[model samples]
Target: MKNLLIKLLHHNTRILQILLFFDLVILALHLTFGSTTPFFHLDFEQNLSTFYQSSKLIGFGMIFFLLGLSRQVKLEMKSFILPLALGLIFLGVDEWFQIHENIYRVFELFEWLRPSKVVEASMSMGYHSSLWILYYIPLFLIFAVWSGYWLRYFQSKLKTNVWVIIFSGLCFLTVLLMEILSSTGSYSGATYYWLVTVEELAEMLLASMLVFIGSKILSK
Candidate 1:
C-alpha cells in the first residue's frame, strides 16, 4: 500500500507538471488572443466568455502544481509573479487581437462589471461588498487551486486504470468531434451554445502539451 501510494504520487506529479506548463502557455495565448464573444453574452450571467476569462486563473494554479511537482521551490510572491506577469501578457495580446481583427469581441474591464449587483438588487438582497469580490475574484482562485489538485488526483488514481483512462480519452475526443460538427453552423440548438470554439480546443491541446512535456523534462 505504501509503495503503491508513492508510485501514484510520482506518476501524478509528472502528469500535473506537464498539464500546468501547457496550461500556462494556453493562458498566455488566451490573455493574448482573448476568449470567444459568445461566452460573454450570458443572459443571466454564465456564458462562454466567463469560462474563457476564468480559465486563466486556473492556469495560475497549474503553475503552482508545476512548482510542487518539481519540488524545486516554495510557493512565494516571486514564484507567483511570473505567472501573473505572463497572464497579463496573455490578456493584453488577446485584447489586441480582437481590436486589430475587428472580431466583434467586446473588452469589459473590471470596473464596467455590473451583472452581479443587478442580480442581487433585482432579487431584493442587500448589497454585500464581500459577495461581489467573492462571486468573481476569489471564487476563481479557489476553483483553480482545487482543480489543479483534482487533476493530479485524477491522474494518480487512474494511472493504472487503463479502461477508465481510455474512456476519458474517448470523451475528450468526442468533445473535439462535437466542436467540429457545431462549427458548421447547422446545429442551432442549446448544445451549439456549449460547443467549443476552435481557439479553445487548440488552446486546450497546446496547454496539455506544455504540461506533459515540461513535467517530463523536469522529472528526468
Candidate 2:
C-alpha cells in the first residue's frame, strides 16, 4: 500500500486535477442546465456527485490508514493518523449509507427526547437537519480537537501545505454548520436547490484537498 502511494505521487499529479475538473463540471452543468435539466443529477441523494464524494472519502480513509503504517511517519503521528483513518472510513460509510439521515429516524421515535428547537426546525426542513446537527455535536468536538492538533503539527513543519489544509478545514467546518442553517427560511425552488448544490460541492472539494494533504504527508 505504501509502495502504491509512492508510485501515485511519483507517477502523476492528474488525480487531483481530474477531481477539480469534475468539480468544475458539476458547477458548469448546474449553471447552464440548472437542476431540473435531467442532463445531470446533483440531488442530495444517491447520484453521480454523491458517489464521487463518497469514493474520495473512502479512498482517503485507505490512504490515511496506509500512512499510519508508513515508516516515514512519526510514532506520535501514527497514533493520531490511525484513529483519523478509522474516523474517515466511518464517515465514508456514513456518506455511502446515509447513516446520518437514518439515525435521526430512529431517534425520532422518541420525539420527547428531541429538543424543542430541533423539533420545530425538523418540521420546516422536511428532514431532521437540526437533530442531525444536535447528535453530531460530540463528533464535531472531537473533529475540532483533531483539527487543532493537525493545524499545530503542520504549522511549523509543512509550511507549504498548512494554509491549504487550513483553508480546507475552514471550508469543511463552514459547510458543516451550514447543514442546518441552509435549511432555514423558505426558499424558492431554485434558491433551495442551488444552496444544497453549493454545500455539497464544498464537501467534495474539501475531500479532495484533504486527500492531497494526506498524500503530501505520506511522501514526507
Candidate 3:
C-alpha cells in the first residue's frame, strides 16, 4: 500500500500540473471573452449559450482525443469525419433554435425563400445575423483534433493519483456549477433550466472515466 501510494503520487504530479494549466486557460478565456467580465457581471443567457456551445463542442473534441489516446481501438478518418459532421449539424440546429421567440433576431433566409419581387417590396432586413458562428466550425474542428493528438503525445509523459482525480472532479463540478448559475436567470432574451439531466450525467461519467484511465496509466 505504501509503495502503491507513493507511486501514484509521483506519477500524478506532472499530469495534475498539465490539467491545472489547461483549466487556467479555460477559465481565462471565459473571463476574457465569454460575454462579460467573470465575477462582476454574469449575463445568464448570453454567457450560458456562449459557454455551452463553445465548451461542450470543445469537450466533444477532448473526448475524441482521449478515446484515441486509449488506443484500445484503431483510429479511422471515417470515425472523426462522421462525428465532426454531426457536431456541425448540432451546432446549426442550436443556432436555429436560438432564433425562436427572440424578436430582436429573425430568420434571415425566409426572405430569400419568398419570391424576389416579394423581397424587393418587403421592408424586412434579410440578413442572417447568427450565421457568423458558422465560420468558427473549422477552428473548433482543429481544436478537437489537436486535443486528441496531444493526449496521445503525452500518454507516457505524466503521472496521476487520487489528488489528480479530485482535481479533475473539481474541474467538472465547476463547469456544472457555472452552467447552473448561468441558466438560472435571463439574458439576451432566452431562459432555460436543467433540461437534459441524463446528458449531464453521462458527461460526468465520461469525465470520471478519463481521470481513472489517465491515473491508471500514469501511476508508477
Query: Candidate 1: where are CA atoms >4 Å away?
Result: 1-57, 64-160, 189-191, 194-220
In TM-score terms, which candidate is top?
2
Residues 19-50, candidate 2, lDDT per residue (tens digit)? 78888887677666655665455654666666
TM-score (C-alpha) between model 1 and the true structure = 0.29
Query: What digit string (tens of lDDT, one per residue) describes model 3 on residues 1-220?
Result: 4344435535544544554454445444544564354331123334443344445444434443444344443455335434543543444344335432242234344654333434343326542222322333465467457546644555454333344444545554554454444443443333322322222333333343353434444342
Better of 2 and 3 by lDDT: 2
Q: How high is the lDDT of residue 158 in model 2? A: 60
Question: RMSD for each model, in Å, please?
Answer: 16.6, 3.8, 13.3
Query: How would you encode candidate 1's per-residue C-alpha lDDT over 1-220 as one tens digit per residue?
Result: 3343334435645565655565455445534444344333321123444344345435433453445444443344224434533543453354334322322122223444445444456346543322233234454475357435544644654465445334434544554455445545666665554454443444344334333323332232
Off by over 4 Å in 2: 10-14, 37-39, 70-72, 106-129
